[model samples]
Target: MKIDARSVARILREPGALRVILLHGDDSGLIRERARLAATAIAPNLDDPFRVAVLDRDAADRLDEEIFALSLAGGRRVVWVRDGGDSLTAPLKASLARPSDTLVIVEAPGLASRARLRALAEAQADCAAIACYPEEGRALEASIRQMLAEEDIRIDPDALSWFAGLLGPNRAATRGEVEKLALYAGRGGQLSLDDVRMCIGDAAGVSLEDAAFAATAGDRAGADIAIERALAEGTSPIAVARSLLSHLHRLRRARIAMDGGQSRADAMRGLRPPVFFKRTDAFGQALSLWTAARLMEAAEQTQRLELECKQTGAPDLALCRRHIARLAATAMAGRRR
Candidate 1:
């Protein structure tokens, strides 16, 4: 059976009669977290050798033995498979065909919809497939509030909105940042806009945005520094490319609005989530230098940069630097003109 977002928490906590559960999605952190919830629900002491078994792709062949083995402690067992893929389809299918009390949890990040493993889990009456994707907009805001509330902290509305915009695309990263804020505020504390900025302004996502803004505003040195900081903080080169692409798309939208007779301020104001106040000038400068048509061309180049970075053995970091340098040069030339 396929699990919906609303039912995910309930199903993970009390998966009645569920033999095999597959958690797969773009958000690896969420998948792993949910898998832990399910595993611990079945076997509270995950370290108990007789009640739990953890396996990777290398030991996937032992799936049958683990699933069928009974717990010596006389409780439900959990077999956890990490980094799963289509390779486990046959083994999983065979295990699901039989009857067992043990719960098998498969954590497959980045699995496709048509994947055999996912399909098998969804088709089985005693199995479930859950998709874990990054939360956005209201969902993200709600999640942040929930996390803070757990620690008995409250956030101002303006601070919440600003903080959400600065968050990265990963759930685990977001949770870590929110936890850090909670600690800073202490229990029963309230957070202000300045509090969040002081706490999380230098996060990897912020640095990535800094690199994007600098590259499009003709600041080669600033772009280089921001990119270095983002990479050093464990941001992927692919993420950097996507950030640049997103900024160019935003610039294209603003340029189109300007060409349609809207003033610069109006176009910038029209942006969804609104441009961060601190970057307003840089964003406006980039908008001035880019025509809608030229921005589209640059977006296509960035799309290619992302694809190239995915290739085996590609010098991803060097490619990202070169691409940012090119954008900076283009912006400088446009300014000169």
Candidate 2:
């Protein structure tokens, strides 16, 4: 049967006799996490991961033979197939016929169009297929807010503005950046903007928030300096560009959610923390002056910069500095009007 992402936790708690699971998504974090959870749930008694047979998509077609003949000796056997060529192509309905002692975890990017896979999964009395896509609309935001609450992290209104502005489109990346902030708090048992700033602190004496602030505030020179510092300290230009893009994308998403009548409290609840608090003044300014179209244009620019950083080599740092600084400055200037 099909399992929705929201109900995954409950499903894990009571697996209900499914021996085969397919967890796939464009979002890497969610995919692997659910895959691991399923693997463990099936073999809750497993102490050694080696007993599990892992078959990559590239493995010879002998996979079926291997699986059929394989025994875990004493432990349970798990045949995990990734980048599923044969796994995705093989008759999925037929594949489910396996010993109860073994659980098969199949992970792919997204296979919604594959009618056979979908039908087989839906018809199965003992299998599940879950689709993991980028988090969106109200549900995603709520998850972000709830994750923080569960983590014991307190996010105030201003901080939420900054965080919601920088939240990633996917739970995996979103959770990853939050963990960085949590680690930044350093056992302090509390999360503040400074904790995020310090934890995300890179070679750029300027924090992720700073570049974001400069971008929204139109402070090109300030942005330039931040980019320069970040580069001098050994941070990759591509990395910085990607970070900026993620921040801007989050803001764009928030603006849409708000327009849809989602309350700021509800919106903030879904945002991950450490949004570079110092950038709130700047980001708020941009949010006020620019339409969603303008912000998305800026998002595109950051994406372009990422490509340039990857393809060009002509004093690449200078190229990055110029655009990033301009982007930062534009972001700040956006707030002006």
Candidate 3:
């Protein structure tokens, strides 16, 4: 059966036989947790989740052969495939059809509806698909409220918004931060924003979000510093640059669509995964700051910097420091014109 993230807790109730599950999202922790829960449901004992097998993309061929040949070791078997590509091998795709006694689970990053495995699963009578994504709106806010309620902690509504703004949309990050905050409060006391600031170590807030915000707002100085801080704090330059490029690209598309008379809401339609509401606002801010000329410059600069970071042996730390500084300075200057 096909299922959404909401049904994960319920679907995981399946305790035996072969199950093929596909789980994935930007949130690595939830993907892992769901996978673990599924496996545990089938085999409570780690020592002998009898005949349990996990296969990554690299081992699909071998795992396919193994599956084609194997039998249950006097107990239920589970074959898990994690970090899958957009499609699986033909043999593997065929296997997902007509669910077997051996459970099959697949985890893909952003596989589409047309993916071969997805096609196979949809066609199969016994198979199921479960879709997962970050929590949002009332759902996300309610989750925070529920977590606090369990801890006998009360929080201000604004603080919850603040917390959500900082944490992004990953369920795993939210759970981790909630756990940490609970530790600090010790099942008592009214939770305040200060407690959130003190205990929750989620990678939300002014790291990437700040850097992106600064860059978009033409705060050259802040952008430079924030970029450096973000990189030092383990943020990948490529990822940030990619984020920059992605939003810029979208802004360009959105702008053109708008010029052709499309509203922001309409322009964003059908965007894969859809742009987050905050991101749409940020994109607007960036468009206001960056003219086509400025974006061209920013894109070119980021591209060159990416090349240098990858190809040359110079101190990446220093190079990225200066490159980002210059990019920010250039962007900041654009708003003045």
Judging by TM-score against the true structure, name the best candidate. 1
5 Cα displacement, candidate 3 (Å)? 4.7
- Shift of residue 253 alpha carbon in model 2, Å: 16
Ranking by TM-score: 1, 2, 3
Instruction: State in Å the error of residue 2, model 2.
Output: 2.0
Expressed as tens digits, the lDDT of each residue in 1-337 for candidate 3 is 5666566677778733434666655556566667777877765654554467777788767666555545445655667788876546476666655345666667775676677777665555556666666665577778878887888877766566556555544566678777777777777667665566556543534465556656766676777777676666555555455545555565567656766777757766644434555556655666566666566667777677667655546566676667656656665676677
Error of 3 at 65 (Å): 6.7
lDDT of 1 by residue, 1-337 (tens): 9988899989999988999899988888788889999998998888999999999977778989999998887999999999998999998788777778999899999898899998898888898899998776689899999999998999998788767755656888888999989989999999987788788877887898898999899999999999899888877777777677768988999999999999999999998657878899999999888789989999999999999998989999999989989999999988998
TM-score-superior candidate, 1 or 3: 1
Reference-based TM-score of each model: 0.77, 0.60, 0.58
RMSD of each: 4.0, 8.1, 10.0
Deviation of model 3 at 62, angstroms: 4.2
* Of 2 and 3, the candidate ranking higher by TM-score: 2
lDDT of 3: 0.64
- The clash number for model 2 is 18
- Residue 138 miss distance in model 2 (angstroms): 5.0
Q: Distance (Å) between predicted and true CA of 129, model 2? A: 1.2
